[model samples]
Target chain A: MELTLGPLAYHWPADIRRDFYARIADEAPVGTVYLGEVICSKRAPFHEPDLPATIERLERGGKRVVLSSLAEVMLKREREATAGLMAAEDHEVEVNNAAGLMDRGRRPHRIGPFLNAYNEATIAWMAGQGATHVCLPAELPGHSAAVAARAARALGVGVEVQVFGRAPLAVSARCYHARAHGRHKDNCQFVCEDDPDGMPLLTLDGKPLLRVNGIQTQSESYVELVEALPELAAAGVSHARLLPQAVDMVAVARVFADHLGGMCDATEARARLAGICAGVSFSNGFFHGVAGYRHIARLGTAH
Target chain B: MTGAEDFSAAGELVCPAGTPAALRTAVEAGADTVYCGLRNATNARNFPGLNFTPEELQASVAFAHARGAKVLLAVNTYPPAGQLALWHEAAAIGMRAGVDAFIVADMGVARHIAETWPRARLHLSVQAAASSPEAIRYYCTHFGVRRVVLPRILTIPEIRAIRREIPCEIETFVFGNHGLMVEGRCSLTNWLTGQSTNLDGVCSPAAEVTFERADDGTMRSCLSGFTIDRFAAGETAGYPTICKGRYAAPHRPEGYYAFEEPVSLNLGRLLPELMAAGVHAFKIEGRQRSKSYVRQVVGAFRRAVDSIRSGHDPDLADLVALTEGQKETQGAFQTKKWR
Candidate 1:
């Protein structure tokens, strides 16, 4: 399966974003890189000035780039931004919102995970809408993902699954990142950038349960599917997505690529990944059809 | 103002009904339209003891039609892969029941209804989360959607701008739970529990809810073995929905409502503003509520809509007793500052 990098869901400094993409372009093993602001429109302009150069650099490095739309499109400017992204003729667009789907019309596009293509019939219908690829929601279980992937493959449309990084759980109209700092969404000055990986949200008992990134809520544990890669490939999944987190992504990419390329076993790859993202919890329970926060050990594997 | 033309210019008052009895109550209480779902995972409110059977739906439709009220079937949940049969069966039953419209979320279900019954009126369910005019127009142009129940994230001005761009009717929520998260996109409950509002058609299912009293005399609301919130003794505790529960962070160790407070949304004061914004229908959410709750809320809105149409300010009913946490806010309807 080909490795793909999902759009960054957090806000970072313009130079930081540029440097991050440059490394991914030159060193990371990901085949397709999704670039754009998928979380907040306010963060779009900060990185948009570097987009053309970044895309050019990535393409020059033999990486295919796809532009992604915002997950929430409520404001007029957000609508216009989505329309602008849909109008791009240089690269394939991955639509995360319905507005992008409408603006893209019958043009071939990718369905981002934010869009609810949960079932086979939904995949079939999206394929009818000229969708060339689809990334299933992170909450979907393995069996259901297999069904959706097979269905999309039958229609000659590629299917993608998130195999790494935090799972995006929800998006709210209110910005919790701002609200947490005692500010309104409109007046709050880019406070989400304080937490490059997202601010941790704990339960009343002080257990880290979720993370807040602007208006989006994400899983506290990174979703690690190193053990499920074979299952995904057997299920006809075309791409394995690795969400960009604040970590050594190039090394993270190498770990997955080595495993997929028969250079290492799942056990070795997982151990190396553990060293790469030390002190961070990893979860595959959502793929196991259980609570997303739980890290269910595979049968016969030592914990 | 004459009889039929009195509230003709005003938007349709759509009310919710969880049972056949509630359906009758909403219709008699002055609802122009009543929406309900079947007792299955096909609908978002797939709660036990709520929703209708095929027989109940047919009888309810007849009762509502006799009272000059329309009946709508909400098959709003996304059908899971290999489980499309249940949703399709529900849609077929809804059509057989002679409901006026089908409120749908998934594109596959919309395509099914449009293909099976070419003339069936389709209203885009809020579960679709189609907030932009382009999204609404896509549904209208593709599946002949007559109306779109917009997501609650849009402000009044945004709605007005959207109405000018879309070629369909608009529906906005006027009362009930404060759904701060975007519908169909939230998986907090699904992450905590196994069921979800999008696929399983349930959020924080009642079976998984538990209330325990700590030795310190705190009332703790738990869902799926996780403590969602803790309330002091004598304090009112809301349902253990993940979003409404309080949480802690390093910056605020005292705990805060990270997503939203336990307050409910009451747009009773914004009737005139919504009408001016070109909203064609006002929807009252709460299919899991009791018949009495349905009656009181629907009746209040009914009178309020009529009062506005007659060039008089609405003497809005005191619905504090029916609201969650006994508090209400205009939410995103009044201003963007609510964000």
Candidate 2:
């Protein structure tokens, strides 16, 4: 199984992003890295100037690089950006929205998780449209993922599943991060930068329910599939994705790599991951077909 | 601006009907088109005690057709893996029922409908979340989609801009739930309740919802055991959908609507503006509401459309009581500042 890094969903400073990618290029045990702004387009300009250098560095480090498009493409500028990305000649583009798919018609591309590839028939249709790889949506249960992965594999398409990081629950036309601060999406002054990981939102009863990052809403707990990696691989999934969070992602990659490589057991890997993402909780219930916020312990590996 | 005569001729009033009764009510109340779904996961409003059976859909289609109204079948939800048979069956039923169009979201469903009938009309469901001209054109080019329902995330200017580019017809939501999140892309309810609008065709499924009276006498609405919102005495409590729920954040310890307030989207005043923007159809969203809601809302929009077509200001009914949370907003239609 191959370890892939998903695009960053935060608004970290340009230099911080550069430094973070530099480390991933050098030390991260990931086979492929997705680079681009998948959330708010307002933050794309800050880090876009350094894209060429980062892509080259990751490529030189022996990692395949793919550019991801925005999850929600409403504005003309966003459409233009999606078109530009779709027209790239070098790096493979991952189409997250329909605009990208339309622009990249019949061209080789990867399907991002943002585009719902929920069923076998959808995967077949995407493969017919020249999609070479597909990362299934985060909400799929184990049975459904297995079915989708098998179908994609039968079509000579690579299947990927997110194995780490907060699951993106929703994307909106309005920026809740800005709205929470009493500002509009237009004049928010880039306030989402304050929460690199994402601003936490709790329920009325004081339970951490979700995280708001610009227009995207994410789960409060990081989705850790250390125990489920073998199950996923057995079900024909070739790639496991790890989304970039505010934590030490390189170390997070190592934990997943070690678990996938059979160098450490699931319990030890979970412990190390807990230490890395110290304060945050972990969940795997989405795979178990229950509420995504709950962590379902494996039957034999209950700790 | 387009002439009043041209606006009236081109614009269509699309209304919702959860059941055969609602379908009749909407058509008789002056809906040019009525959209509904089968009682299954093939449509977004897969609530129990709602939607139509095959026989009911056939009767309703005939009834609407007799009144010079078109019937559209909503096979909108994404079919789960190995579950295409269910949606295909629903489509076959709709076809046999002689529905005028099939409103769809999934590519597989769209491809099936396009390939099966070859000449069947397809309206891109809002759940597809196609906001731009390119995306809409993609559907029109690929599946020969006749019309596209724009997501409730675009402003009037954006809609006008899109109208200048796309080849197919444009449909915009004129009233109903202010869906803050992009349709088909949202899984907040699934994360909390394990049933989603995209996959299961339900949001915060009624089976998972519960209501309780707190010690202070305030009503607490919960979804899947999580407290979504609390309403004071005599305040109308809204459905326990995750997005419109009140939440507590560090910035505001006092609970606030973290995603969106529980307000309905009422574009009654924007009829003339949207008509001027080249919108081919105005859609009302409430498949899970009552038959009376269908009559009142559809009748009100019918009069509004007629009044606007005659070059006069519309005298719309006050639908505040019928709206969610007893309040309404023009939503993202008027301005992006609604964010």
Pick out the ten consecutive residues of candidate 2 chain B with the lowest summed lDDT.
Answer: B1-10
Candidate 2 chain A least-lDDT 10 residues: A294-303
Give stretches of model 2 more than 4 Å off. A300-303, B1-8, B317-325
Q: What share of the true interface contacts does each candidate keep?
A: 0.76, 0.78
Stretches > 4 Å off in candidate 1: A300-303, B1-9, B317-325
For model 2, fnat equals 0.78
The per-model lDDT (C-alpha) reads 0.90, 0.90
- Residue-by-residue lDDT tens digits, candidate 2, B35-129: 99999899999999999999999999889888888888999999888889999999999989998889999998999988888868888999999
Model 2: which residue pairs collide? Answer: none
TM, chain A, every candidate: 0.98, 0.98
